[model samples]
Target: MATPMLTSPLTPRLTRRQLMRSALAGSTAFAVMPRPGAQGLTGPAYEVSAWTGPVSGFALVDTTGKTWRPADLRGRAVLLNFWASWCEPCRAEMPTLQQVADLYGPDKLLVLAINFKEPAARAIQFAKTTGVTMPVLLDVDGRAARQWGVKVFPTTLTIDSRGRPRQRVQGEVDWTSSAADKLITGLIQA
Candidate 1:
């Protein structure tokens, strides 16, 4: 007969034994992972491609024509989103990201939207129409995207406080969801 396991209060579905097993096995926890073509999801099921490498440093200009460097944002958690103007899902998720930015201010978390090969005027117009106030960085030649292994549009990567790439979502996600809130909160605190 199989032995019963004790569940952990942190996640009722994950048992204490299972948690320990995952810890020992080096498992990436996905809290509410959606399958491909999952209805109600903003876009396709987000691919949980966990990249534990350090993000490359780069300099980019925001819509306001202010230059920013990745090296300057090392001490705080950063949510780097790769997006394009033509991507519908990317536009759809901007409001959610704005909400997240508002909730977790720049002090705790920095939400940066990197425009993929798009002109500053179009990106600025889109952001203005969509009511997304987060700073939008212009990736003129896809250099940063290539270095970050970003093959998909609307891909989101979070860098920890120490400037280490932590988690990644390969599609549009409901960033304002409570589950995401908890995840972001934990990442920031970590």
Candidate 2:
């Protein structure tokens, strides 16, 4: 009975006003500046933090029933996002995440939008309605969320080509911004 990624226990719905407030407040907060030696890099929404180490023993299953493992993505960078439909910040970041996925394409990067504990139909419908073209993976029982230690509504991990996490952005982000683009480009090429 692990709880889903910040959408909570999957019950007790939040009102629209509450969602909006949460979105506005959080979207304006967080995001660390680059480190001392990182040079002219920029990340307006993603935190510039220490590496969280290699994320192994994790495999997220996609909508098509295909299991995506680290080995399968060894040569390409990965942006693993944990999100839920009920969370407004997560919803707000959808378009930018989609742009990142589409911009890099599968050969160079893998942007996974993992929905936590939400019904597959609801997740599918949300994506369809929201125009999020990223691959939607379901964490129906919340196990993946727990395993990943993702307690936030939309925490994104930028993993480099060797399956190591380079950055952990603990909130929603404008993944389409030029700063985000540069950060991701550096990860993929480094």
Candidate 3:
């Protein structure tokens, strides 16, 4: 017998607009706030809301057995990517994410791949097969995801250098794209 997976009825329903946005593979989505000093820029590749939650702290362990928290990552822009091994879109955008991580380096930016409710072996194997060198954190109980208000797979939270939550992207994004580069560059420079 298998245990039944349950979901909260209070989980916020996704709007049709959101469904459309997430439908586009490798599309970037975030709040439509005008980036300061970014004049004549086009809209985001997709659309979603900004992060409006506490930026206080969180704790999760990486595949290498190291525990991490926000305090441990201050003075650097952090991209907390919530994903699961079975999610196709999540797997698809990973290489581009690695590219972004390598482009910025560990000092300027840290991209943590937070695997949702999966075993450590699974994430490790996926990282090994995919050659993702970034820190792959495990949310084995899904607590970190819930705390971060991630109701969707492949959601990414961007934290600026000052440890401020900047954007909440709720879908797959081609991190190598110009739009992604601009957003990440702004975070690094902020």
Off by over 4 Å in 2: 1-30, 33-48
Question: Which structure is stronger by lDDT: 1 or 3?
Answer: 3
Considering only N, C-alpha and C atoms within 3 Å, which residue pairs clash in candidate 3? none
Backbone clashes in each candidate structure, one number apiece? 0, 0, 0
| Position 46, candidate 3: lDDT | 39
Superposition error at 82 for model 2 (Å): 0.6
Arranged by lDDT, best first: 3, 1, 2
* lDDT computed for candidate 2: 0.72
Model 3 scores worst on lDDT over the 10 consecutive residues at: 33-42
Give me the runs in candidate 1 sitting further than 4 Å from their true place. Answer: 1-44
lDDT tens string, model 1, 77-156?
88899999898768778889999999888988999999999888999998898888989999999998888877777888
Single out the weakest 10-residue window by summed lDDT for candidate 2.
33-42
Q: By the TM-score metric, which is better: model 1 or model 2?
A: 1
Query: Which 10-residue window in model 1 sums to the lowest lDDT?
Result: 35-44
Rank order (by TM-score, best first): 3, 1, 2
| lDDT, candidate 2, 33-80, per-residue tens | 322224422333334444474577767677778787767768889888
Alpha-carbon lDDT, every model: 0.75, 0.72, 0.78
Model 3, runs deviating above 4 Å = 1-46
TM-score between model 1 and native: 0.76
